[model samples]
Target: MQLTQSSSVEIPMNDAKEVDSVTLEPVDSQSGMDGGLKAWLTVVGGWIAGFCTFGAANSFGVYQALYTLEGTSSASNISWIGSLQLCLIFAMGILTGKLFDAGYFHHMQIAGMLLYVFSHFLLSP
Candidate 1:
């Protein structure tokens, strides 16, 4: 109630019907997620990537044993190498996921394959 030296009741008017009339239009932003050939291929690619990275980490026992036999590096140093490799693998997965989200999966995968091959070449000493 608002009064200026005079008794008067002012009822607040609501334009709810006008507001309700303003409907929202939905946008088609998200792509369809049908489990077709492409979707299955993506799943297989993910599986291969996961195995190559995490599976490599899991095989560190064999690596450590071989390295120990060869006397290539100390136990502590060899352990550090495995840990560093695993850390880099996981850390870079985030970067790769971002690149994939930005539609650069093929480019990134090619780069990764080249890097892997180059690393193997370096290890051929």
Candidate 2:
């Protein structure tokens, strides 16, 4: 009853006491996670991604300063922009983090990238 990447299954016939085992192959073969090429690439990529995300998160002060200089909005009202950005990031992280844990990483990654590009185009003047 145990299933693995290359495990087999046993089927018993109604009229016979013999059992037949059917070998199964995994749909996709994964690169080793034990310090393999994929693992190193993932580590590097994650570092870069973390750098970008945190870098943007930390730049909110610059944005708030600029907004305050503009005099078009109060400092408190301008603060909401940064607050909303962080809120969306953490909220989406919760949903996307679960998707990653559930092994829908590629699906989520594609959807996220598409959404990012689409939003850029949408919000651009």
Candidate 3:
């Protein structure tokens, strides 16, 4: 019943003419399946990232209104900016997903935060 390296089992068929062979390997018990502190931390970090990114993007209407009131830009032009922001968010999600699958999640996370902060600094007068 115990499976180890290169361990295989054979089962006899009802007709006793053919046998089916199956190979089994022992599953790693500690392959990050504990769902403990690390899992919860990752969940919370994702929630925070979503809040910072999506939250600001979704609130573009307020910014657009302010811009319109200040007469800095036309309503249509301001709306276009909001649309572009949403599109970039979606497009970047695809790129980021690829990087995540490639195991550069921590690097991307750090780079994203730095970029976010740097952008805010550039935007500040």
Among all candidates shown, the one with the greatest lDDT:
3
User: What lDDT does each candidate get?
Assistant: 0.74, 0.74, 0.80
Return the TM-score for each candidate structure. 0.64, 0.59, 0.69
Q: What stretches of model 1 exceed 4 Å from their correct place?
A: 1-33
Residue-level lDDT tens digits of model 2 in 21-83: 444555545653376787889999889867866676678788678768978789999788778
Candidate 3, lDDT over the whole model: 0.80
Tens digit of lDDT per residue, candidate 1, span 51-98?
886776888778788887899888888888779888898788788788
lDDT (Cα, 0-100) at 41 in candidate 2: 98
User: Residues 1-125, candidate 3, lDDT per residue (tens digit)?
Assistant: 65564565554456555555444555566664668898899899889988999998888888888888989889999899889988998999889898999999899989988988897686443
Q: Considering summed lDDT, which 10 consecutive residues are worst modelled in model 3?
A: 18-27
Clashing pairs in 1: none
RMSD of each: 12.7, 8.2, 6.7
Best by TM-score: 3
In model 2, state the lDDT of residue 32.
Answer: 39
Judging by TM-score, tell me the better candidate of 1 and 3: 3
Clashes per candidate (backbone, < 3 Å): 0, 0, 0
